[model samples]
Target: MTVTAESALAGVQRIIATYAQNIDAGNTDVVADLFTEDGVAEIEGQDTFEGRETIRKVYGQFSPQTPQLHLVGNTVLTSEPGEEVTATSNLVFFARGEEGWGIQLVGTYEDTAVLVDGEWKFRRRVTKFL
Candidate 1:
């Protein structure tokens, strides 16, 4: 069956939502599973995580004391038939510090997504701070 644009858009949205939820919950295993086996995640001016294992390790660095909330918005997506989908969106990072909840960073995420075993997975995501 061919994938429709609407369905692809929804799938990508779900992928983004799941990523944020898992990251906020500190479930690195699940977060990493959202990506392709060799997916790449690049954080501007920081380290780049390559592959699922590395992604899991990087996310594992987050602890209860350093909890974060990711807010995603203004998503723009483009699809190429049923093969791939690309998306760009605004991202706001909030954290609970000694004081209170506050904005930690504001950035943008450019993602490349593909279907893997009939599931949408992130092939690459580049995060840049603004």
Candidate 2:
């Protein structure tokens, strides 16, 4: 890959990695921070969240009793080049309990990211049940 393509991939990967880390670590604010100010998120056939605040609320449902870990598979990524990128990837949702981790939801996320201020921010994230 060319340097530019590599850089773009790095930016996208960073965004995905940070999201997983913050969500798994229960950093709610950080989770919200990963998204754009006007970002949107749709949860697998569930209702669609319209903004950062809305997404925060949806994420809030993952309480201490049910911590979540979202695993994104690279093989499912569909990213594009340039300052804008729209991609979709499969996500394996995990929940923690006394017995240990359990797979809860298996779905896909369609993400629209923009290179804003030299950084990538997700403008929209739509999920579909598989």
Error of 1 at 110 (Å): 0.5
Clashing pairs in model 2? none
Candidate 1 regions with alpha-carbon error over 4 angstroms? 79-81
Every candidate's lDDT: 0.87, 0.76
Clashes of each: 0, 0
Cα displacement (angstroms), candidate 1, residue 121, comes to: 0.5
TM-score of 1: 0.91
Error of 2 at 67 (Å): 4.2
Q: After TM-score superposition, what is the CA distance of residue 17 in candidate 2 from its true location, in Å?
A: 1.1
Lowest lDDT sum, 10 consecutive residues, model 1, at 74-83
Over 1-130, each residue of candidate 1 has an lDDT whose tens digit, in order, gives: 6888788888888899999988898888988999999999998898889999999888788644577799998887854647698988899999988898999899999999999888999999999999
Top candidate (TM-score): 1
